[model samples]
Target chain A: MGEFELIRNFFAAAPCAQGGEGVALGIGDDCALLAIPTGEQLAISTDTLVAGVHFADPCDPFLLGQRSLAVAVSDLAAMGATPIAFTLALTLPTVTTDWLQAYARGLSLMAQSCRVALVGGDTTRGPLSMTMTVFGRVPNGLALTRSGAQPGDLLCVGGELGNGAGALPLVLGERTAEPAIADPLLAHYWSPQPQLALGQALRGKATAALDISDGLLADCGHIALASKVAVQVECDRLPLSSALVAFLGKAGAQNAALSGGDDYVLAFTLPSVELPPLLAEGWPIHVVGRIVAGQGVTLLDSDGQDITPQTRGYQHFRESP
Target chain B: MGEFELIRNFFAAAPCAQGGEGVALGIGDDCALLAIPTGEQLAISTDTLVAGVHFADPCDPFLLGQRSLAVAVSDLAAMGATPIAFTLALTLPTVTTDWLQAYARGLSLMAQSCRVALVGGDTTRGPLSMTMTVFGRVPNGLALTRSGAQPGDLLCVGGELGNGAGALPLVLGERTAEPAIADPLLAHYWSPQPQLALGQALRGKATAALDISDGLLADCGHIALASKVAVQVECDRLPLSSALVAFLGKAGAQNAALSGGDDYVLAFTLPSVELPPLLAEGWPIHVVGRIVAGQGVTLLDSDGQDITPQTRGYQHFRESP
Candidate 1:
């Protein structure tokens, strides 16, 4: 079959493409038609992941596919929008049915899990890469943004941190770990789930929010600049996974959790009073810091010593290749 | 500045990125928030252009930028949707300030011309490729899809074709032309205007439609398969521009129009009875063929003799790398 037919038969034939909520017309069209309901808004994001840059070139096709969609969907999760549809622009060096099938399986698996539909896409001939543009919906004026943090608000994270970064040693073939440590760390690196539920639960409750992609410190700095408030992150209070601690050790794990990249956890700010109900209801909200009146971010020791961050997270252009 | 800062300052600083219609929030966020009108449905499409495969690597970045956005927006035009916003995913091997400034200028020019805004995007270091996902809005049940044709419907085109295909020889340095012929062909190649207005006029009138990116005959095959109707194209009636004929001669231009790709024109089917009024309004609609009873497409000469196609348009996988 031709490339277009490959896209039609494989990617477009998935369950989500058969017509789901908001998708008026799915594949086999110039553009996918989506009906946005009244009193709602569409949240859109685009992310490109390149082989050998974003991940290893010869990595498992299934894992690559899963990681690709997961990273892009995390943006929507940060916006507190319900998943709707996504378009995949895939470029491959060669047409290998095995690779395509595995990739499609991984993409389909993630689509089903996230409740996202494959609306439309184009397949091309080039180096290995994928660019995913996802669309979701949120009620008007209710989407969470990184520009609403206020002084005296509590800063919390939805899940454990440093797992993705802790997997780097194993991912690059520099280290080995026991299954107890390896399983969770590798899972976090390959398939970090977007906390869509937590984002929705925070809707108007959290004053500011964003997914932790570029590490906790860098992304929280985004909140600080946009919300124009200072943030104090307690080094002792970070919620590191047990697997990560076991894999990287205490001080190393602490550094990775605060400064390492690719953690898709949610870091948000809300009133100190609002945390109890969510915590009481068994949400995974771990309070790590608080918003202050000034600007910039300050890292503190357990003893309240001023041990501000000396290192920054990954910035694509600034780093040497 | 970092990659994110580069995007925010260079691309996000474009006029279109600043609070245009339907865009509630634009760049500098996890996701761009857009509000489709009460009765409108969202139309989405994505297209990727890679250096060396889609275009020459050393080609003008400015023209590449213009062509990239134009190609994706053409799909929106074909869907009869008004352009709203677009997200650009750019993967580059190196950082060149001058190249980015020129490219952004070209992108901003087309975004302004097409009335589309820059919403959100991600920039990364990798092979040179750009993926643009565009969004637009159309009234419910009014999108012009490629699935509604019937027998006896008059097949027409919105504007002249073959110019883009006819430009390939010159684009690849295989041939050269005088200014009068070369300029139009080059423009058609680098920056063909999307027929947004023509598509809007055809909304409820035309039965089925799509932009002719994959040349006429192959795109006609798309309508045939989707709508389950036969299409017949008369070679003598194709609307070719003087510039194409001057560059490639009559026979060569006709072959290019029939078999070559990258012509961003609209092809549609409407009843012969509905043509007069649209024509009288001077909308540039040219009748070229008719829908027939059987399936697939048949190419005919002025003598009304059948000469079905032996060539297909550009399919990435089918092409020899």
Candidate 2:
């Protein structure tokens, strides 16, 4: 075999690439085989992170590896699907064994945390980037979708929000703080846990669901658009992590919670009655707002007055509108 | 919504993104849901192509779109799986409406040709590259694999090879030829038709199968290593298209067939008893060699003398042995 094929061997030897439940066959094949249970639908999502575009070029490869898989797996959580397997197509300007080993370790850790196996992937030389396609399975008619929310449903988030956004300054090396403040924020930035169990818990209870990648207001707008109902965000109720609040202060943290992206937290609309049972079951269900009769999404002040901002979240492109 | 999300809308409106058979949900969701049939396994593969490495940077985006998806689907074909759907993770240096339209059109055409839906994808700004992940379904215990070859099996290729390699000079603007030769070679390079039907036909018959992306010899070595049997390729029996021979001469075309990469043709090991019926049914089964009780791959002259070349095929990295 050529030297390049050895890189593939390195990945093949990774713990996560070994066959796991639902994986009929893993790496070393032209195609990996996944066995889906009868009556289950496969959930698939693809996410790409480009060096310099998605993260700093010199950022930690280990963190990059963890973040990449975590973000992709979050989509499965949004869909309320059980994590199955994932394939990564990685491109790099050059091969560095040190970088690869560290990256693979991070990937393996995330795969274990998310309960997903590394099934197959392609490795190539180019500008550094990676695309992860995650697969999951959910029973037919049970996978969560954004189009099912009703007018009276309460909107909720899985847990704390804004930490990823609050951590950006630190990640770009523009700011530094006490370890107590920076640690949690940086951890959220580099290793956002996909709320898979919470998503599955919300499957039958949630009227509509999605993971918060594009800030809270913008992602809520997606649900409003898809469900044909207005969403009201209670700005006062927005969840902010302690580290985020310490770093950005109340107003900045609140703004980050409202308009920041990359949170990777589940946001969903649920019937008010469904909340108590799930909350009692210990799911991290945090009420953030409600669905109303109007169209589009609106942010409301404590007095319930309209206080929406023009720029709701981060946008990578500026296409003609 | 931000202008950048419109790029997603552009793809969402493409013909291939519409829900099709086995697609429970298509675009505009956190995850696309695919319904896997009972008693069938899902086959998946990912392939990435980077500008300047896999193809010319300034080459036609339309052709790039087609070639990118086609090559990825070839892996499903190698697994004897029925086409279902695919996701695209596209990274671009910048957004160009004209480029996006042409590229989407090309991708749509290829998707239709392969009968696979564009279920979902991610579009981001970065150095130009794309990763395609294709999903297909095959019956349990029936999918073809690369580790099933046994001694006394006939080594075969689905059709003519080396056209992709022979067209490289023309693609790079270093050579010119008549339309009869150049047209076919360029077509092979830009739009290889995955032999899905042939692969399905070989199910339970061909002991081992894989698409030839790493040339005949190198890929044969993969089969030999996996199946623990040596593959003998009779150089005199190598199949070459008239166009390839016309462009590169017989010896050059033979060399390309042996050592050049990106052919995207299926090579398989089938018991000698199974070939006649398939050939009778009009499958382009070409007997190139045979499997023997040994290790590695061997290239033999007309007189049956060993003549293996040193460098087998393309490799992106050179790691220490």
Candidate 3:
């Protein structure tokens, strides 16, 4: 067998590629088969990460394996879909057995944790990059979308935000700290857990929902435009993790929470009546702001003054105007 | 809006990104939603094309767009599934308006032709590469697989072959040919049609099926290994297009037909009873061999002697075994 064929076999033998509940056929086929039950809709999303662009060039492959899948699966979480399967299209500069083994192990562990099967994908030789496409099943007409928020909806988040962006300095070796603060931040960066359970719980409850990847303010802008309502963010209510606040000062952490991307925390709009039961059920629903009858996203200070910054979030490409 | 956001709008406004039959949600969302009919299984496949490895780096984005999607959708045809939707994860080093417009046009044209909707995708800054993940649906328990070919089945191809490999020399500008010969061959290489109709027609008739991406003989070996039967190809009966034959003489064309890796034609095994009706229906079914109680694939001469070549097909990453 050829080397790439061996690579295929390696992935096929991974624990995640083993048959799963909805997977009719896993790896080793032209196309993987998935059986979505009647009255359910399939949620699909694609994400691509490139070396030196999305992450450090010489970073750990195991961490990359986990982070890539997690980032893509987060979209399914935004849609409140139950995880089903994912396909990875990996492009590498060269073949290394150790790298492949470590990457597959990390992928398998994450897949097991998320209950997502590894379906079929292609491996090609090229500049280092990976594209992951995730699939999930959601009940028909019950999916939380970005265009459903009403004027009086309350804006909430699943958990603490900005840890991922705060870890960037440590990830790039530009800063160092005691392991206590650094470890948690690094873990959050390498493996931000997709809020799958919370998203599913918010089904038929959340008016508008999305995982915060392009920062809280910019993503709220997405919801505002799509739903045709204004999203008002109260800066004092932004959830800042203890680790993030310890690493970056209070003001820095707040700035990161507002504009630093890669949080992967679900920022959603919920009605006041739905919030009580969800909070009573021990879900980590943090109220950050509210939806109002306006056109765009507005950042308000404690005194109810507009204090929006110039840079909203990380924009990937600065093209010629 | 940022440049990448503008890029997103460019694709979102494309014709293929508009809603379709099975697409519950198209672009401009965290996840694209698809609604499969009751009693149907979703077939998913992913393919990646790197600029330098898979195609010329400075080649036309329009043709690259067409070829990338077609190559992925071919997997659905192999599984006898009706095309539904696809997502593209595109990574480019820089943003160019002309390139984006032409590429989107090509992608939309091909998507419309194949009746597949462009549901969603990601745009990132990196070296040029495109990963396409395609989705399709087939009746439960009726999708074609590579493990069901019986010993008595006849191996058949959907149409003519080898034009793709024959066009390679012309593609690289190493050789020139008459327009009549080169046009057909180049078109075959750039935009080979997925036999979706033929695949659905073979749903219950053909025992095993797959699109010929890795050459006929090598792909036949795949069927042999999966079905635990031997596939014998009669060299004299191999199908060849007139354009390919004119470009490369008989022996050269025959070799290309045996090991050309871009055919995208369906190779399947059918019982003798099923072939007559399919042929009478003018489905371009070309019988080239038969299955037997053996372990691997074998190429036969006109005198029925074994003549399998050493190199079965193109194997990416020729690492040490």
Q: What DockQ, on C-alphas, does every prediction get?
A: 0.88, 0.73, 0.80
lDDT of 3 by residue, A1-321 (tens): 474476567798999998888999988778999999999999999999999878998889899889999999999999999999999999888887888888898898889999999988988888899999999999999888999999999999999989999999999999999999999999999998999999999999999999999899999999999999999999999999888999899999998899998999999999999999998999999999999998889999999999988775777774431
The candidate 2 chain A region of ten consecutive residues with least summed lDDT is: A1-10
The runs of at least 3 residues in candidate 3 whose Cα sits more than 4 Å from the true structure, single-residue gaps closed, are: A1-4, A319-321, B1-4, B319-321
TM-score, each model? 0.99, 0.98, 0.98
Candidate 2 residue-wise lDDT, A149-221, digit = tens: 9989999999898999999999999999999999999999999999999989887889899999989999999
Give the interface RMSD of each candidate.
0.9, 2.0, 1.5
Model 3 / residue B287 / CA error / Å: 0.6
lDDT digits (tens) for residues A1-321 of candidate 1: 577788877787766566678889888899998988899899999999998888887989988888899999999999999989999999998888899888888887888889988999889989999999999999999999999999999999998888888998898888998999999899999988989888888887999999998889998899999999999999999988888887788998988988888999999999988989998888899999999999988999989999976777878887675
On the 0 to 100 scale, the lDDT of residue B208 in model 1 is 97
Fraction of real interface contacts that model 2 preserves? 0.90
Model 3, range B1-321, lDDT digits (tens) per residue? 474466566798899888888998888888999999999999999999888777887988899889889999999999999999999999988888889898998899899999999998899888999999999999999999999999999999998878888988988888999999999999989998999999999999999999998899999998999999999999999899888888899999999999978999999999999988998898999999999998899999999999999886877665531
Model 1: residues with Cα > 4 Å off, grouped in runs? none
Ranking by lDDT: 3, 2, 1
